[model samples]
Target chain A: MKTPALIVSGVLALLLAGCATRRVDESPVAAGQTTFATKEEVAAADEHDDWDTVAVVEVHDPIEPVNRGIFWFNHQLYTYVAKPFSKAYKSIFPKWVRHGIGNAYENIKYPIRVVNHTLQGRLDRTATETGRFLVNTTAGVGGVMKPADKIPALADVPKADTGQTFSKWGAPHGPYLVFPVLGPTTTRDLVGTAGDTALNPVAWVGLLFGGAAWTTAISAPSGAHGVPDQMDRYDMATKDALDPYISARSGYIQYREAASER
Target chain B: MKNIFFLLLGLCVGAMTSNASTEAAEANLRSTIDQVLVVTKKGKGGQSMANQLTPILVRHMCFESMTRRAVGPGWRQFTPEQKAEATKLFSKLIIRNYSKKFTPGELAEIEFLKPSSPGAGKVEIPTKTVYKGSRYNITYRLEDRGSWLITDILAEGISFVANYRAQFDVLVRKGGAVAVIASLKQSLERT
Candidate 1:
């Protein structure tokens, strides 16, 4: 188990190194100017009518080539492995059973959300989230049901994360990215994800408990719970896209923007 | 005095007409979903369901506008024939892709919330789709082109047009209108 973890860490380090070096300036189109002058002429002629040119000029996708490569890798993994596994998991379990598992996972990850909200100085949300966690854990039977939602005070509190906390701290969403097995993200969100993972109780258990207990905690519940929903979201975002990678990126950016508004 | 009374009455009638049209538009959208649901329930793959949905989609969706927006500035470069061809291909592509989403027994029901008047001629209807035990928000943005036709769709706030435009930009930059048309053709073939 340690061997597998070490190997994953090593591979990730290499990937990150690759990503670090490939960070080009904002315009990826500049690279194509030498090879595609005719296309550039067309772009120049109809510059005013081009919404894509105007809209994305500000969005710094410096390493789009690498991002696209990662996107393809992620797509294949989803298609051949993750999606099938998610479907199988869904088929085997009843909806309520799956929901219960998801609730449990969400409950476990409460600390991350609560901490981020606190960091962002959202004291009201932090308090409500804490109350919700406590209520759900006790009243909802270890959060198999969201009984806390019944409580008016807890119902309207928005979910927060390290990513939002980073945003609140004025960190820019540095370039669009596609991580292997993780799908779409940005540089800031990637850091936030890392922070969230470190803050996760399951990760702590894996560290403190060690060996079999750690493995069981990591491999069970949390790992399996959210796969179906993730797959469903991916399908919805990419199904109509002429290019799934482009569509997924667009959807992700828009989704993040909407999420940030909350 | 008679003219003033007539003007007030006309304003009241206009408001009622607008309200009635909004309701009618919402109803039309629901019926369209029902039709799609029927095809999905049939569980027949390929040309059959595609054939059933093509006309319904063509009538109810603003593919010409959607395709134009998606293609962006590159749209101007396309000739009349190219524009028409691209629109046809893009529409077919959407229909083909969308039809694949309807899995038998998956979509339980859809509940449309109050239609919001986003603009003078636009209505945005937010619907909650209950699939199995999960609920997802799918918003339909329709424009009044004599009838309410779907201009865009947003699943959990991810707009279809915006997403496609992001991709179409890169394609246009790398190639041009010809490349975009070619890419659409390839996508159609793949589907």
Candidate 2:
């Protein structure tokens, strides 16, 4: 009786909350959808544009030589290797298939997200992340398809990470460093990255279950997944600038800062 | 039971009709972008290309709206004259910065994908583009102001509006409209 009552209440709640949202409807108010610029809304809007705004965070690039050399190496790698591979991968897979793969990868990183969310004391976000994980894992066929994307409570929330957690804790970003393949990072974020890697289930499997071949197979696809996207965006952020290095550095810093704030 | 069936049938037709409109919106956006691309292809470079693109951009992009939102809540403190100045300078600043991103005489291969209506009068048209030897995903968000006008652009999942707003909001909170105007001027000069 209680279960039936709870199910009925859930149905009623969803029904009451639902509204007829149209696609490309010619209504005036749709232009000014009351999604206001609250502090929270910034993350939902996605990553930053290429605007050079006044609110600058100065990155301490003490190891400029190392960073620039790695940046140069990475640029060459991306141009020569990643670009061709990504083009081939994209041609082979449809957008939905690629998106599903991306969703699955993101889904598997649930521990890193939930842990960071918890560390930052974002209980609500942590709860939603857990809910998203459960729903995606069960209904989404091990999260190859993202059924949670349709859920109002789970939609559009940026995934949390250890770097963001540290930033929220008021840790200053130390020297900027760029790895050959992994690309840009600050000293603080490098540590965060390591911590995140430790928390990842895939990393655990590789370590514990001797899943070397599994990791190798997954690694290639993982590397290929976002190469086109990352390289293209990197070009957009840094290209045609007076100093490409400076532009890339600033963009990286700004992106990290924005993500941390959210 | 009869009423519910009719309601579902009505919704199905409504969706079909709206999907048609969404295609129209996509067509209109493609046309608008082509005009801007023509200007970009001219290889005018720097301020020259920006100046040419401004009129077309102005026709399609709501600078006043962008200016208002980018300024965030601090826009309320701005006077009429200041708001006008901010909008003008901001539009110029954005055009210059954005136009600079395009290389002269290079046209990107853009593939427009399925369009979705996130709400009444709002359409998000996603595109995959191969530009300058790299592929990128770009999404254009349009709102109906009698006609569809692009409100925001996302490049590789980065929001153009949110990026500007993040910086502007900080400045506005720190120093108000004057600071924002000054920052705009400095950025414009640098560009």
- Tens-digit lDDT track for model 2 on B1-191? 99999999999998987887698789889999899888888758877888788888888887877777666666777899999999998888667767877878988888888899977777899887877644566888887778888877766555566556656755777789999898788766663
Task: Assess the local accuracy of residue A30 in candidate 2 as a C-alpha lDDT between 0 and 100.
Answer: 25
Docking class of 2: incorrect
Q: Please give, for residues A1-262, the per-residue lDDT of candidate 1 as tens digits.
A: 3454355445444433211111112234433221112344444644334333222312446677898899889888989998899989989999889898888888888989888787777788888999999999999999899988678788656678877766655555666677788777877778779889888887787778766577576758767777887888788777667788767766776666556556
DockQ score for model 2, please? 0.10
DockQ, per model, reads 0.30, 0.10
- Compute the lDDT of residue B113 as modeled in candidate 1: 79
How is the predicted docking of candidate 1 categorized under the CAPRI scheme? acceptable
- Clash pairs, candidate 2, are A23-B117
Interface RMSD of each: 4.7, 9.4
- Model 1 score (lDDT): 0.72
Query: What digit string (tens of lDDT, one per residue) describes model 2 on residues A1-262?
Result: 3454355335433433211111111222223222224433333333332122223234466567787888888888888988888788889998777777777887899999998888878889999999999999999999987788679898546679987776666565666778889888876677789889888887776777687876666666666777766776776665433345655765676667657766
